[model samples]
Target: MSASASEGPVECGGDEFKTDKNLRTSLSGLPSKIVAGSGFHGFKLNVKNTGDRAYQRVDFGVFAAQVDEEDYFIDTSHLTLQYKDPASGTWKAISLDETDEGAGYLGYTDVKAHESFSIDLRLAVDKSAPAGLGYAISIGMYADDEGNCVFSGDGSYYEFDILKAGTAPGDPGNAKPQGGKKPLPQHQPAGNTKIEPQGHLAQTGSSSALPAIALAGGAAVALGAGAVFVVRRRRNADSGTAA
Candidate 1:
């Protein structure tokens, strides 16, 4: 059932459905590096339902942290998430609902079996976001009211660096996939929107302390549930962000 305009979409993290094995997701288009205070940056999220069961609703959430340091959460207040409306072909800001653990979530409905849909997403970094490396942005897709998640394998999260304004990013030709995972194909931006070149910046100082729980792997802490599955990596305990 499609959610009414007034009712909005269903909130994720409920016990409504079971996890589906055929669902898969991938992200592309975002640069490996961005400048602090950069305006809306674009990316594409593709969701594929490879099985035979059509889903009534699907929910997703995103959270970020400074992975180079333990428990150093980024200030998400300066961040904004937006999606391109398929019907209107216009960009709309998603009204984010926070989880008890502080992740942000929203939902979409009516995904038929064996079908695929793509969402054009934009992430706006406000001027106040601290600049540094080891920043990881993670996403989780849930069905069954947040009970079942799409497989938390490759492509669920992306790691990058945020350079201070006026700094050059690393050469794109020299860029390599982090954690030995292959890079997903980049999505082309629509209109005149400019995407920064993909690359990493040299690490600087320490990151400011913010409230966040550390998940064992880079997976997002599901709202009202245990940690969502994602790729695991050994943390570089010696590396820390600038305060």
Candidate 2:
């Protein structure tokens, strides 16, 4: 959904927020490891900023491994990244792949101290995902320069149950309704039903009525003038005949 980056507690606004301060990077919450066939809707991890400084242009490592690799941890080669805004609770799908080292996933300080910021981790369901539920997901922060980065071995691993392969999310053969379905017509009763008369009031200050009224008034005035001119012409003709 949404996320926020700020200083101090997430609720308060104060002078404790600062830009130059050092930010504490942490991978506190990890999403439950998923199986190959089990369906998942919202997979989220929280990358919390525990320090006071505004963090920018930083790199974070994401690793996923099957449960079989318990002896030696293996990283998932294919990775996708997305972001959630803490303030608005909006989740935006990010198109960046694992190669996007310097872009995507950004956060800033919310207070004067710049101690607090949060990043929501997200992933979508893939058909080819692994089946066994036992897996590990981890991350580490790295500096832009080579060999300069923050690495905490196995930040936090969550054990999850995996579903069997080829399992669907919902009922089988049921298709979601699309917008192209036509609405059904309403059925009327066969008998003579006593229906209540529906009424509506004319809206005041309508522009359409004004033009019609002006046209009618102009026609009436023109007719009155023509009538007067005809009467005067008739009188003048009678006088000329009498003369």
Candidate 3:
């Protein structure tokens, strides 16, 4: 086999997934399907280190991109992250925006040479989500081995499109394969929406001590209502003073 046919990139590496076929198939069981109202196990981001350098930490995040921006949206408060503990072989919460003070990223996971780290994502589509409603997952990888040497641009954060309820995990058409970035029109967003990434920005609290901006349910309502309240108060004062 030619060197070209071997594998990808020579340095810090990445993959769509490293899961076994049987396991992938089994993950499609009734229990693992992307159902509404609950956060169940979803896909995993597998990062492999083929390079000789050891990364003190491998930072990554699974952000949402909308393929079907219908009536419902993902309840991000319900979205969470988990990393597999190599020691006990268990999944632990690395809850992104729920970190100390308010919002931040868990950049403590490390990847050593020839080793790999798996970040498990737990997600839920909103209730009453349309059947065709879909969203893609985008990933960002950065390696700061205490020395802050190199990084991977990003991979397939926009390739996935998971259908809403009634779709079984075992179904072939249930979800798009994990990572595959395609060309999407500039004006026509294939899976881009208001939802933003939930990771630490430059190792600071989401935005340098500022609260994370949330546009989830009722945000717009609050803004409009506040305007109405101010207008009404001014009108009342004017009416009282009028002769």
Candidate 4:
């Protein structure tokens, strides 16, 4: 999947792409080629407080959206978080379950007035994942002071593709196969008619088979008649020879 293909539709009108004044955040450096066995710590989420009010307990979240069904190959399992130690001031890997707010988010990253908070982010794609698939990544931020940060303040959506392993970028994407083809019109029984699996055409009604069986029986009767006539001819020939 190409990066453009993974990026969903963008609406041009009416605050569709505007950022919220109070909380503005962006996720950057997502890999175009995601590999399952590798860890990427270079990706980052930066949340900045743009509003005048300084809020406490300000929390930020990294939420993922799998836009297409193919997203099953990649998930939050491929993402991890790290925090800078307040004492050592060194980034240390942390468990999402330890930091998650129980509302399905990554961390409770806090930001202060006119300041920004950034975290070390990582992503890994499963080695077994198919050649093409992706997930739409977004940063979800909320705080005690406001609902969300966007003027539209919804979510910032970004795209990443699990490019086909052997193919270069811009290659034609393999189409996702469509499903739910109406099962071959099952043989429906009307009244007492029964459908039997006599052979490959079992689903077809049995009436059509009757003519073939009748013709076979007629051939058997004709063969018997021929045998009887041949016996009488042999008996006459033997009598003529004896005379």
Model 4 C-alpha lDDT per residue in residues 108-184, reported as the tens digit of each score: 32234566655555555544545443433333322122222222143334445554344455543322211111111
Q: Model 3: per-residue lDDT, tens digit, 164-225?
A: 55655454333443332222110100111111122312222222222121111112212222
> What lDDT would candidate 4 get against the real structure?
0.35
TM-score of each: 0.56, 0.35, 0.41, 0.45
Q: What is the C-alpha RMSD of each candidate to the true structure, in Å?
A: 13.8, 36.1, 17.7, 33.7
Off by over 4 Å in 1: 1-18, 64-71, 95-103, 133-155, 170-234, 237-243
Pairs with backbone N, CA or C atoms under 3 Å apart (clashes), candidate 4: 19-151, 20-149, 20-150, 20-151, 36-125, 36-126, 150-153
Model 1 collision count: 10
**Which candidate number has the best TM-score?**
1
The regions of model 2 sitting more than 4 angstroms off are 1-40, 48-57, 67-81, 85-114, 125-130, 133-148, 151-154, 165-243
TM-score for candidate 2, residues paired by index: 0.35
Error of 4 at 217 (Å): 73
Q: Is candidate 1 or candidate 3 better by TM-score?
A: 1
